[model samples]
Target: MTAELKLALIHSPTEPAQEAAKVLRDRYEWVPIEQATMAVALGGDGFLLQTLHGMLDRRRILPVFGMNLGTVGFLMNEWSPDLLENRIERAKTFTVTPLRMEIVTVDGESVSYPAINEVSLLRETRQTAKLEVLVNDRVVMPELVCDGVLVSTPAGSTAYNLSAQGPILPLDSALIALTPISPFRPRRWRGAILPERTRIMFRVLDPVKRPVSAVADQREVRDVATVAVAIDRASSLTLLFDPEHALDDRITMEQFAV
Candidate 1:
């Protein structure tokens, strides 16, 4: 086994990425983005999310090395030209599973997708949306009048979930955060930390009066009547990081930072 060190480069179509691509092409034996054991991603957190979405599979583990080229490179490496191959060879690994969202429209149309960050349901119209939330087929909150509701993975606990006054969960913890965007009826309903295996269901109170939209990461479906969410532990994804700067440690440190 010749170590199977095939490298792929995925970059945002930016000036910096173009320059970096040229450098990698000139120096290394790189393959197409679709056929590489390790993928070097260029851009910020958004691009990283897109990359994860593009290459999400359980059996095929593609270690990704991201060099920051966009703003807020929380999931990226510091941009540097030196010791590139060395850094990749010595990189660490982090395994993450995305949440699966099954959304049904008012007309009985159904669509399912995976969410690496979070699955959110928001009001599509001007009227505040009313939702009935359930966990594992049990009615937890009968009437959750709010602008929106979200279920976030531990890896995504820091994104939209945190800004909505949700708790920051540790990455290794097998927990999911069920957070409300802006609750009106349940004013004191803070949030819930459910088991990763639990299935969550959200039913729209009135699709005609309060139209709602459900989003599984970047994929959005409007006029949603009901949405179900679950963690896809069977089909998870893996991400590689610097051993010293592991993603879990970074997320843990983000909370205590001044």
Candidate 2:
């Protein structure tokens, strides 16, 4: 099976990743990314996200197997140069859909980006950002005064959302977390979890005075007036992990971490 599959090697520019890539290249034959059915990524979670984003941008999705060579390899498997083919052959597959974020800037410019992790709206200055939260065009929270807020998919709930005290969602929960950074008003409002199909819209109040910026994973847009986020089910990506250390198991174990 391994011999029949065309594999592409993608690695971060870091020295460790570069060195690992050299060893892997010498041991295995790799085809160009455009011609490969599967990809092997070397680096940490950040690098894996970059590789996934690249595939999404090019509209050429491929199942990716990532090895940890950087810090906090939450999205990567244990690095083992030997038995790579065997590991991939026995790997478990996980499918995750990204969020599509549409932003209308203060200048009336429209832009769109995809976020595999989460979409965040942050205050640009010392002043707290005031936002109106709307779910499916219906007003929920008329005003949310906070340092920032984020919408996270289950695949990303353990990331920034977890840091913001968001609930941990199971891989098949079909739920998304709406977490607040630091709320001044509505002091008791921690956050909420909505269905995956929910459309979340945040309208920045007083955009000129208390400007807010929107970020979709790594991409950022400054001075956003309104931002909309929803799951892009059609653009789902596949990740392959070792059966013993699958992503769902890791996420479940995070809840037990002290």
Candidate 3:
């Protein structure tokens, strides 16, 4: 009996990805993207994000293996065709829950989406975004004068959250990072680590004076007057990595190296 393995390949529009696709076609039986148990994503972090979002939009969950074909390969593995089966069989699985963002637009429009990494509320104009932040229905910060604020999952903390000076959380740790970007008021406050189950609410103090936009991964909502974020652990996404290069070790190494 032949070993029946269905594989799906997703690639970025990069030179390396085109070359890698040829190699994949030569080695395995390619299946439709929707019918595969495993997906090989060929791209840098950005493309990986795109693939994840695409899967989520389709309401499908599958383990994804990423190869570096873009600028940053932090979430990707070293691309090699030699040990593909061995790597897949020995891959470690980690489950990550995305944050759900609900935003109410200034025109009374309501939109909601899920974010694999974080949900950010950013100032739309040159003026700073003044917001009132609430956690678990209680006001935590009455007035947050800043360029933006973001709540990131542990898997997403390394992305935009890191650039905003947020802490690097271990993948297994059940916590959320609330980081303020370029804050003007509340000068001493950097950020906070909240329980994974907490719900965060951000209300723009003055929509006309301080216009804000909310983004859930690649999905964007312009002119948002209020936004709420919460981790949806019930529905999760899984990522597969070679056992030796598990996500935990990578996150640990990232801390001490830089």
- Pick the TM-score winner: 2
Tens-place lDDT digits, model 2, residues 1-258: 365889999999999999999999999989999889999999999999999999999999999999999999999999989988889999999999999999999999999999999999999999999999999999999999999999998889999999999999988899999999999888889999999999999999899999999999999999999999999998999999999999999999999999
**Could you give candidate 1's per-residue lDDT for residues 51-125 as a string of tens digits?**
888776334557788888998787777877677788887778777889999988999998988999999999997
lDDT of 2 at 164: 94
Tell me which of candidates 1 and 2 scores higher on TM-score. Answer: 2
State the displacement of the C-alpha of residue 175, model 3, in Å, after optimal TM-score superposition: 0.2
> Where is model 1 more than 4 Å wrong at Cα?
1-3, 57-61
Per-candidate RMSD, Å:
1.9, 0.9, 1.4
lDDT of each: 0.86, 0.95, 0.89
- The candidates, ranked best first by TM-score, are 2, 3, 1
Tell me the deviation in Å of residue 242 in model 1: 1.2
Order the numbered candidates by lDDT, best leading.
2, 3, 1
TM-score of 2: 0.98
- Poorest 10 consecutive residues by lDDT, candidate 2: 1-10
Total clashing pairs in model 2: 0
lDDT of 3 by residue, 1-258 (tens): 025667788898889899998898888777888778889998898889888888888888788988888886888888887768778877888898999999899999999899988899999999999999999999999999999999999998888998899999999899999999999999888989998999999999999988999999888999998999999876698888877778778887877865
| TM-score to true structure, per model | 0.94, 0.98, 0.96
lDDT of 2: 0.95
